[model samples]
Target: MKPQRIFITGGASGLGYSLALICAKGGWRVCIADRDIERGEAVLGSLQKIQPQTIFMPCDVTQFDDLNAAATKLQEIWGGVDVVVNNAGVAQVGSISDTPLSDWQWIMDINLMGVVRGCKVFTPLFQQQGHGHFINVASMAGLLDVPNMSAYNASKAAVVSLSETLQNELKPHNIAVTVVCPSFFRTNLGQGMRSTITGMQSKLDKLMAGSKLNAADIARQIMRALDKKKSHVLPHRQGRIAWYAKRWLPRTWYQRLIHSQKK
Candidate 1:
C-alpha cells in the first residue's frame, strides 16, 4: 500500500502548518504550499525529516495558475493525492460602510476564490484517482455573521456555501468534503489582518490570546472529524454554542448582537 498524500495551502503557518505535521506523522506524504518561499522551505525541511518524500511548493492562492501548476506537478510525480486542503485566507474587520471594495476583493480572492480554484484544479485529478477528500477551512464568523466582520465573514461564508454545494455535487464521484469552522485560537492570523476600525486588531488579538485551544489543538480535532468523514467540524466548544444559538435563536441572537441600536 502506498502512502496517502495531503496538500495544504497556506501550509507554512497557522492551522495549515499544524495540520501538515499531523498528516505527516500519520504516515502520509505531505505537500506544504504557500507563497512565502522562505517559510515554506523551512517547513519543508522539518517535514522531510518526518516523511522524506514530503515536499514544498510555492503556491499563491490568489492566482489560479499557481495552484494549477502545483496540482499538475504533484499528479505527475506522486501518481495521485488523497486530500487537498484549501486553507489559505486572510482576515479583515470593519462594518460594511467602512470596508472598501478593495478589502472585499482581497478577502474574496484569497479566501473564497482560492478555495474555488483548488476545487476546480484538483477535481479532475481526484476523478482520475477514483477517490479524494477536500478539507475547506472556513470560520465561525461565516457561520455566526458576527458584527463588524463584513468582509471576513462574507468571504468565509462563501467558502462554507461552496463546500456545501460541492459536498452534494461531488458525492457521486467518490469524493468527500469537510468544512472546518473553528473560532479564533492562538495563531499567526492576526499578523496579516486588515482593519479600518481602531483597536479592532488589538481586540481580536486579545480574544485569540485568550483562547484555550491553539492551532495544534484545533488541528487534532479536525483530524478526528475527518477520520469519521464528517461533513463539517466545529472544534471549539464555545464556537458550537454560538452556532447553535444563531441556529435556534436567530431573533434573540440578532437582537443581542447584531440588531442596530441608536448610538
Candidate 2:
C-alpha cells in the first residue's frame, strides 16, 4: 500500500515543520509548501534523512495561483493528497485602533484567506478522492478576546469560524476539518510578528520562551486529534481553560478576568 500523503503550508519552520517531522516519522509522504524556498529545501533535506518520500514545493498561501499549482503538482506526483494542513500564518500585536489598514489586510490575507484558499483548492480534490482531512492552525486568541492582538485575534477567529462551517459541510463527504487553537509555543513566527504596542515584541518573546510546550509537542497533539477525527484541538492547558471559561462563564465574569490579565 502507498504511504498516506500529507501537504503542509509554512512547513519550513515552526509548528508546520514539527508537523512534517511527525508525519514523516509515521511513514507518510510529506510535502512541505512554503514561500521561503531556501528554508523549505533545507527542511526537505532534513526530512529526507528520516523519510525519503518527503518533498518541498515553493508556495505562498496568500496567492491562490501558488496554491493551485501546488495542488496540481500533488495530483501529478501522488494522485492526490490525503491531508492538507493550512498552517501558514503571521502574527500581529496591536490594538485595532493602532493597527494600520495595510497591516490588517496583510494579516487577513495570509492568516484567514490563506486557509480559505487551501480549502477551496483542496476540497474538490478531496471530494474526488472521497476522503481527506484539513488541519487549520488557528490560535487561542480566536476563542477569547485578548488585548493588543486585535488583528491576530480577528484573523484567527475567522479561521475558527470557517473551520467549523467546513466541518459541518464536509461531514457527509467523509472529509474532516480540525481547527487547532494553541497558545504561545516556541516558534519563528515571533521573528516577523508586527507589533505597534510598545515593548510588545519583548513581552511576546518572554512569553514564548517561558512556555513549557514546544512545536513538536503541539504537533503530536494535532496528530492525536486527527486520529480521533476531532473538530477542535486545544493543545495548551491554559487554552483549554480559557475556552471553557469563555463558554461557561458569564460575560461580566469573563470580562473581569480579561481585564485583570491586563494589569
Candidate 3:
C-alpha cells in the first residue's frame, strides 16, 4: 500500500519528531499532534520545507476533549489515519515511599491515560476505515522496574498491558497494535522529565551518558517493525536481553538486579 496518512502524538520533538521526519521521507501524509502549538508548528514548517506534506495540530493527550478535537480535525483533512503512534509521555521519578499520591496520579494521567485516550478516540474511526495500526510507546522500565521511578514504571507497565490487550481485541478488525519497549536512546526525555523531589536520583543522567543508540536509529527500527506488522517492537538489543532475563530469572535474582545496577 502507498503511504497514506500517519498521526503521531508528541511529534513536535524528540523521537516523535524523528519518526515524523522518517515517515515524511517515505511519502506519507504526516500530522504532528502535540500540546505545544509553537513547537508543533515549527516542526511542521521544517518538515514542510523538506517534505511539504506534513501538518501540525495542537493536542494535549491527557485531555479527552483535546484529543477528540484533534481527531476530528484530522478526519476533515485525511478522513482517517492509517497509523496512530501514541508516543506522548512523561517520566516522573520517585520511589513508592517518597512519591506523593499527586505525583503518581499525574504520571498516570499522562503516560498511561494519554495512550488510553488516544486509543479510545481513534480506534472507532480506524475501525470504520477497516484498516489501521496503533503504536504505543512503553519503556524498558515496563519490562523491569528500577528504583526512584515507581510512577514511571507503573505507567509504562500499564501501557504494556493495555497495548497487548488491544492487539488481541482489535485483531479481527484488521487494526494492528505494537508495543515499543526501548532501552535508553538519545532523546530529550531526560531533560524534560519531572521529579517529585530533587536529589531523588540521577539515574536518568547516568543512563543518558551511557546510552549507545540514537533516537533516529530507534525510530528507524520502529518503522521497520511497523512495516512487518510486528506486535512487540524492541528497538535495542539490550532491551531484548533485559526482557528475556526478567522472564527467566528467579525472583531473587530479579530483585537483586532491580536494586543493584548490574545485570
Candidate 4:
C-alpha cells in the first residue's frame, strides 16, 4: 500500500520507538507521536539515521484536541495514513480497595479513552481513503486479572473489548483492527506507571527488574501482526498460554489465583 504511511502513538520510547525503528528500516514512511517533545525528537533523530524520511510530532493521547491536531498534521504531511498504531498507555498497579477514584479515572483516560479518541479522530480519514489498519496496544492483564493491579486490569480489559467491537464495526468500512496483548516486557512501563499510592512503588520497582522480554522483542511481534493483518497479537509465549488457560478454565479458579499465589 505505497510503502504504508504509518502513524504511531507513544513512539518516543519503548515498544513504540522500537516499532518506529523497524518500520523505517523496512522503508515505511513513519510519523511518531508522543507527549514528550524532546524525547520524541530524539527518537526521530535516531530513526533518521536508519530512514531519513521519519519524523516526530508531540502528542498526548489522553488529550482529544492534541490527538486531533496530530492526526490533522500527519494527514497533511503524508496525504493519508495506511496504518495507525494506538500504542500510548499508562499502567497503574493497585488493588481495587487501595486504588483511589482519581487513580482509576487517570488510568482509564490514558489506557482506554486514549484508544477511543485515537479511533474517533483517525477512522474518518481512513474511511475517506477506503483502507487502513489499526493496532491497539492492550496488556496481557486485559485477558486476566492480577493482584495489586485492579486499575490496570480494568483499563486493558476495556481496551480489548473496544478493539474487538471496532474490529467488527469497522469491517464494512474496510479497516482492519488488531489488539496487541503483551506480557512482561522490559520496557519503562513499570517505571512509567502512574500510581496514587506510594506503598506500591517499591513492589512495582521489583517487578520491572525481573522482566524477561525487552522492548525490541515486543516490537517485532507487533510488526508481524501489522504485516500479517492478524486480529490479535500475542507478543510472548506465556501471554498466549495465560489467555488460553483463562479461556478454558472457570473464573473462580482465576479469581483464586489472583487472590493468592497458589495455582
- Please report the TM-score between candidate 3 and the true structure: 0.94
Which stretch of 10 consecutive residues in model 4 shows the poorest summed lDDT? 254-263
The candidate 3 region of ten consecutive residues with least summed lDDT is 199-208
Best by lDDT: 2
Residue-level lDDT tens digits of model 3 in 166-202: 9999999999999998887667785667776775347
- How high is the lDDT of residue 10 in model 2? 96
List the lowest-lDDT window of 10 residues for candidate 2. 1-10
Give the distance in Å from residue 128's predicted Cα in candidate 4 to where it truly belongs: 0.2
lDDT per residue as tens, model 1, 1-263: 23478999999999999999988887888999999999998888888888788899999998899999998899888888889999998899888898899989998999999999999999999999899999999999889877788889988999999999999999999999999998988888888899998987878888898888899998988788777889999888988986777788857755585554213
lDDT by residue for model 4 (174-242), tens: 999999998776676765776656766666666556667778887887777877878998877877876
Per-residue lDDT tens digits of candidate 2, residues 17-67?
999998888899999999999899877888999999899999999899999
TM-score of each: 0.95, 0.97, 0.94, 0.92
Q: Which sections of candidate 1 miss by over 4 Å? A: 1-3, 257-263
Clashing pairs in 2: none
Q: RMSD, each candidate, Å?
A: 2.3, 1.4, 1.8, 2.1
What CA RMSD would candidate 1 show?
A: 2.3
> Model-by-model lDDT, in order?
0.88, 0.92, 0.86, 0.85
TM-score of 4: 0.92
lDDT for 197 (candidate 3): 70
